[model samples]
Target: MTEQIAHEPLDVLRLRARRRQAGRRSFRQALMRAATGIIGEIKIASPSRGRLIDNARPPASIARAFEAAGIDAISVVTEEDFFHGNLALLSKIRRDTRLPVLRKDFLTTPYEIVQSAAHGADAVLLITAGLADDQLQPLLSEALEYDLDVVLEIHDEQELVRALTFDPSIVGVNNRNLRTFEVSLNVSKRLINRIPRHILAISESGLRSPTDVIAMKQAGARACLIGEALLGADDPRAFIAACRPAFVA
Candidate 1:
């Protein structure tokens, strides 16, 4: 199924996507209500670290655990080659959980956005590093057309500058450099405040503990996307609860 979708014509993919319902769970509103939102990820593998989890454990089962743990949203790595994920995983996770599911992939085309919607994604990650200047806005616009929230992901000052031009609703500052695949929390710290207060900022990568999440929140990030750490934890639900910020009464 995944291989077939990858080879399908753009028009055919669009038609399939359009046939499915568009209005999905809101990824934006989920973060807006939290003091510090936690987006638990269902990542099976990665290029930098190799396979992270036993793929034998169903993705939906993990998603259900996240929902039970009070996760604000879910991120599913759907990039086939390096991540060992596909849209089918996204679909299964979406069906099994109420949390808005994000499609985390190196998407470079409008067709992929439509495919995301067809597969039941509530949002899609658009990496600034992967997109050309002209390519960014159009791809963003395509996601918007399907009512899929866009996580405009950036890694540096230049990408941040380009992302701001679009006035993205949600900006994700990825700590891992796409080129080097090296992770750091300083990347989020350096850029979080630079993002306007009105736009939701999500700190991604290199976050392993509640203390790390607190630091990002203190630095002005409203949410943290934790994948590798959560998947590797002895108790993911307990880890998520600990990572959540204290709520003000």
Candidate 2:
């Protein structure tokens, strides 16, 4: 017989736990007040390395490079299962820099939101694909109470519609399809017209060069969430800085 697997109600458990821990903190308001531009993302290698393993860069070095390059924000992956990230690494990055740190995780409940905010994250990623309509308000509410900026991410049309339901301040269009793992820049461009102009629009995934930034800006994106390209570079910061329009000019 095939081995059976046991699963816990992680979402339910986390939601209950977060509700009990709720207290005023202020990440959302600060994020809204801040500028959304050129968010440099830091990704750790998974324990099971992929084809990009040869280019792994330490988080410290990565953070320093991005800072020197003048990035507006920094995102640290805290997912351990697939991204090979650690919460400890995020804490270290947070303490080391003044730039707003975004906790780039699969945030599912208020508990995870509180944990991120309390740990010094200025922002948190909320994927529309992972949440339902009824579940979003509670999570967003708790995150707001903790003063965390929410980067609501969507992968497609349906998720985009769901994301708009919250009137999010910051919206990220992820090019990577969560199911097939395929990436296409068109994802963000396709959804751009539908997004409200007042909201800070971010393009994520498949962004490779400064040209990509130009294209995205022209397509109406205010910012881009880049991970693989920077992580794959020998000089990550320089690569990101080079992508800046001012630097290029």
Provide the overall lDDT of each model, using Cα atoms, as 2-decimal numbers. Answer: 0.86, 0.73
Tens digit of lDDT per residue, candidate 2, span 1-249? Answer: 011112324454345435533442233343334443677788766433453333454676678777777677788988877887766788788778767788998877666776676566778898888888888899899877656778899988888888887999888899888888888989888997789988878889888887787788778887777777766667765766566662232
Candidate of highest TM-score = 1
Instruction: Provide the lDDT at 57 for model 1.
Output: 77
Clashing pairs in 2: 26-146, 26-147, 27-147, 27-148, 28-147, 28-148
Q: What global local distance difference test value does model 1 have?
A: 0.86
Residue 218 in candidate 2, Cα distance off native in Å: 0.8
For each candidate, give its TM-score against the true structure: 0.92, 0.81
